[model samples]
Target: MPFYDIYSEDVRCGRGASKSGEETKTAEVFAGDEVGFVVGRSAMEPLEPHLIYHNGPGQVYLSQSTAADVREYEGDGNWFKISYHGPTNDSWWSTRDQTGMNFTIPDSTPPGQYLLRVEHLYVRYPIGTTQFYIACAQINVRPPRNGTVGAKTPSPEYMVRFPGGLAVPEYMYEWPNTRLTEYKPPGPALWTG
Candidate 1:
């Protein structure tokens, strides 16, 4: 895999193909199962403190558009529907520094095509001044074998928008007094159903 510029809104594996993606068929996992991806970081290190800090990383459901437009989902917010998040690990500084990160899809997730959005935050400046790196993986989800469709899916309340969901002043500002234990990933609450 090659390094993708964070600001370009390009699909991680697009490789200059197209920002929206080529409707390629990737992996298919059950609606409620474990999925994972390996994160790769640039060989070069950032010179600044915040740029070098690898504290928070997680995955979000970018969107569930058609087969051709699965990559249309991008950006940060409640609508992004973050499904899994890993807290800061003292052992690693960047996502690329880690391997085999995994998260589970909510059992109630709607069955469809999706773009799994993975992101890592390098907290260098202040609490709110964090930089983010994001990538997307194409996935197809099928209704469980039991043949019950939409019976265990999430409710509307589970749907959240990012910037609006995490618009609190405190969320943007982090200080030494902040309690790491009380930390919550930025976005709507996780949909555990």
Candidate 2:
């Protein structure tokens, strides 16, 4: 496997960014908060630009076996509803540095621990190729509540679980050598109920 690096940080959650394996949390806020992620990369060689998709919604409905079955879905478009904020090209260096991406959890987004899967791909030449995985960060989106500067806001009791667990898979496509490499991120640091 070639050396590919993936790094991410939560903008809403104030924390100095670090390589994958570092654990972080978001600031306690209302249920419907617009959260963003600052994702960057460093690799031995320039990598081809790939698509980043949030498979959260699909995970909410699919079963564990079904979720892991990437073949069941047809391309990134089928697996996730993607929204790009960066350059859309086939160049590998597009994501080589710090790139900012934002995702707003619906006001109706249940308050609980959510798994945000980040998938990288080079989708201009041979369909889906060039892949990498980033460490999953825990986001604790609090619920609405009344306050008088010190009143405690009760946390909602909603549970959000990723269909195939939180361990993201890492695979790569080296043209002639196409192989699926299992990449495991750091373990879950904290648990929410």
Candidate 3:
């Protein structure tokens, strides 16, 4: 659950380089646009046969807050929503194997300042241990050119607490187990908005 700001640093530091700090850079995205991140050293392999939708060098989420200033955002309200990839699991892959990953910005998402959060979850390595590599990128969400905002709205169903979201199963953290066909992603359900 240790959080960083970006992934453009030394690999020796591992995912620690993305941790949030005093300084940060902002990436801009329109309400409806495709955004992707280059597979940097921050990527990690999953412990189990991860579903493509949940697998990642890390999961990318969007929030209006920087995630540090809790005074402005608190409780479930501070939560960030997963950026929609698509209907299929085509975007899923081992962060270690892929060059990058992409997702579409929903037109319904509110336009404002946001923090693009990237998280890399590792369930192996120590065998039965779980580690997380999280990074946040500052972003500004602009309205679509037509000026018509999406009808859909963000709701509680799309929110989940960071440190407490993933409740790992013994099969997921331990190696050599059954291959699960269905998987509920660690956090709350995907917010279409």
Candidate 3 lands at a TM-score of 0.63
How far off is model 2, as Cα RMSD?
14.0
The count of backbone overlaps in candidate 2 is: 3
lDDT string, candidate 2, 27-98, tens digits: 454444455555444464346542343211111110011223222321111112222322223222233333
Pairs clashing in candidate 2?
47-92, 48-92, 50-121
- Evaluate model 2: give its lDDT: 0.30
Query: Each candidate: what lDDT?
Result: 0.51, 0.30, 0.51
Model 3 bad stretches (over 4 Å): 1-22, 42-58, 66-77, 84-96, 124-128, 173-177
Instruction: Give the residue spans of candidate 1 off by over 4 A.
Output: 1-20, 43-53, 66-82, 86-97, 124-128, 145-153, 161-178
Most TM-score-accurate candidate: 3
The candidates, ranked best first by lDDT, are 1, 3, 2
- Residue-level lDDT tens digits of model 3 in 95-188: 5444555777677778776656655555333432445555455567888667787635567767655445344445544433223223345566
Report residue 3 deviation for candidate 2 (angstroms): 9.5
